[model samples]
Target: MALATLGVVVPGIAAFYEFVVKGRKRLGYRVQMDTTATNVVETDDPGVFDQLREPLVDPTLVLLRIENNGQTHIDEDDYAVLHDKKAGVTITFPDRKVVGMVVTELSDDGMRSSFEDGGGLAVKGSRILLPKVPMNRGAHYKVLAALDTMNGKMDQYPPPKVACTIKGGVTGGKIQETRSRTGTPKRVIALIVFLVAIVVAQLVVFTQSNNGAPLDCASGHLNVTGSTAFAPIAREAAKSYQDLCPDATFGFDMRGSGEGLQFLDQAGRDGKADGQLTFSDGEKPDDMPGLLPRPIAFFLFTLVVNKDSGVADLTGDQIERIYQGKITNWRAVGGNDLAIRLISRNPGSGTRNAFQRRVLGGVREPGTNSDDCRNRDPGSPPGVVRCARDSTDAVLRTVESTPGAMGYSELGAATGRAGLTAIRIDGHPATVDEADHGAYPFWETEFGYTAGEPAANSLAASFLRYLTNQVGADIIRSYGDRPCAELANPQLCRPT
Candidate 1:
């Protein structure tokens, strides 16, 4: 009877390890594609392949994908290698020599810097060494390697031998060599189906126990209205929340920040504020007693100029002078002799308010002079051509089209736009790291405002909780903003 119990208990433990414990810190790798099957070596004309400097007798291209296919994040310090060792894993191609390798794709652009020269990504002999890259859940990167079979026949292409010499810090962790999607084993498929069914059953039980309401879910409609600069993050977060809670819905009315606050104020006075929410670029006014504020993230803003401007950096004094109409032409600031056009946001814009408070020293700029922003208005002075735009997109478009035009916009909105360059301030780039270290000043604390506090179980309250959680923080960081909760100094998000 003891032996029989041991037999059953051992198998149960094995199944639990295989299905549950094994996936918590898994490092999965797979050969996405091998060019051996399609190699047609034309020996007569080697000149056709001039793209490679080194001549190859028998070339094979291998695309390898390495991922953190696990539930938790894998930090760089989690690698189980020596302290001085740079490589986390070494992949060997038997009977083949590695000619070159390049990182092809990344799940997140922030991982690109990890593949730089000193990050341990190198090709030595028949092996490719990889760095200890930290990966969040579902994050992956692809490396495309050019390999030669040492003049061996290409017909018998041996599979790669992946060894985790550089990647061993995980508990109960083993680096797995996975097959292609079509070659997945039947037993693995059955196990996955079984685990999914178990999870579904648990979820059903949990919902039933909670009186028919799902975890972290509220059934209602919410209207998210606020800073157009933060609209991208807001929309993404709302979409993710709706996906998690199918009964919930969201409507967006992203006007300027001040406008959004005023709209929420009126909604609160009318007792319709329960369904309305607004996000501001900074703190709300002291006059609005009923409204409550919660800091969500730190948004970075930058000054952008047309490509023809030839100016890259500006001092705070120079910017203030330009807005104050003391400087007129681009040549005055070491650029071409073109006339300077100022594209600015309107009075109700929160971004404009932040700029005035932080950069302009609480001083307001001269009123908008030109309606078209090209030439001065008929009765206005013939100095700087100043105009006001209602939204961040309008400011960027105007700065992109008009030569010598300059404007300020959210960093994410200004990035990668053609014909405009995001300039620096006092030689400091507009980056989260820079802002954290106090080198950058063009940023603001983004706040989510409600009309007093919504009920604990209300949709507005639940959505606010979700916005500060890990999922919403990821979405916020993806757009180049830094969530306040993740800040090195949490006090930075507080009202000054």
Candidate 2:
């Protein structure tokens, strides 16, 4: 009875093993495998070795080998890392497709294989001793092995290809081969050439447009030189005009009215410039060329003081006294007892010239008895405070910092300084509206100067039209300047 039981148990165990091993093969179930094919395989069918190949999907590892072929030792810096040392490889596929891939490597016994995100396609280390587990069969594959260096220098390498096969008891395997693609380099070169041609063409267009017909009503580059007071308004106007006519450009220089007139006078005689605008107080200079044209825009010069000076207004006579070195203390002007520190422009300033002509009536000298003025002349009379600043920004800086300091500046510059206050002139507030309506006592027009009538219908004319337009006016106002139309008595042409 014991012997019979043992025989029955042994047969049953053998049958169970056979069923587990061969069940899927007999049923003809296909197994989808990973790229390495190292994982155990399973099947629904009991039996079937017939394999179908799926195209090798996107690869993760691409090995590249670069060879110098020359005998020179290459430095490490000569080679650039791929993707800036990030984990990507460059490769060519068996189908001649080129791609950069990311992959993982596994090694055993001095042999290596790579795995990527794609389906089960892998390169085995040794073919004879270690047959590849089959992926879906018949798929083509190519893999770059690794980056290699010649003479200690790293470089790129061509990839290797492999075909899938199954033989004998081995259900899957990979075969190594080579692949080549034609015309790829030529295509890349052609693309680069096309891009370069486009860039050159654009450059030519830009150059031609910039150098086009001068000032022919189309608006070319206009050189504007005159009062710094007018510079902000003119600059804003030029920019606005350029926006309207993109091809036109304007150049402005903030030379004083005298310098502008001088340039215009010279250019007029030499037939160089087209128009002239002078911001003089209508006391036209004797030497000013009769041919030069007149003003275009009027601007005002006003006295600006420290906001804490407690002075809000001044009469012309009081201003004369303050600038002439009469009033040395703010208390005299209804303010605290701080010593008045007066600031004035350089003698050559158009603003200075205009102030002398209008406010001083050309009689009172600036350096008379005022501590603010320092005498360059040995026997000169006492002078007003000589700030000797170069630009409006400089003058404002002094006024804002020096307690009880008073200076004259363009209304635009004085508008927003923290410590500065603009005084009402003769009871009328210094404002854009007042200046526009001619109510502001300090209001005046600015001018541009050119030699002759601008070349018929040139860029100069276009620029002038643009300056007078609503758009340009809007920009001027935005910059704390009254627009040209606003300065007009009727004030009808409002900025749009």
TM-score of each: 0.62, 0.49
Q: Model 2: runs farther than 4 Å from truth? A: 1-219, 274-284, 362-365, 368-384, 432-439, 479-496
Q: Residues 251-321, candidate 2: write the lDDT tens digits.
A: 66666666667766777677666533333323336666453343454465688988768898988888888
Clashes of each: 3, 59
Positional deviation of 110 in candidate 1, in angstroms? 22
lDDT of 1 by residue, 110-184 (tens): 888778645678778899999989888789897767667775666767888887732332345667876657543
Candidate 1: residue pairs that collide: 80-169, 88-166, 88-167
Backbone clashes in candidate 1 total: 3
lDDT of 2 at 434: 74
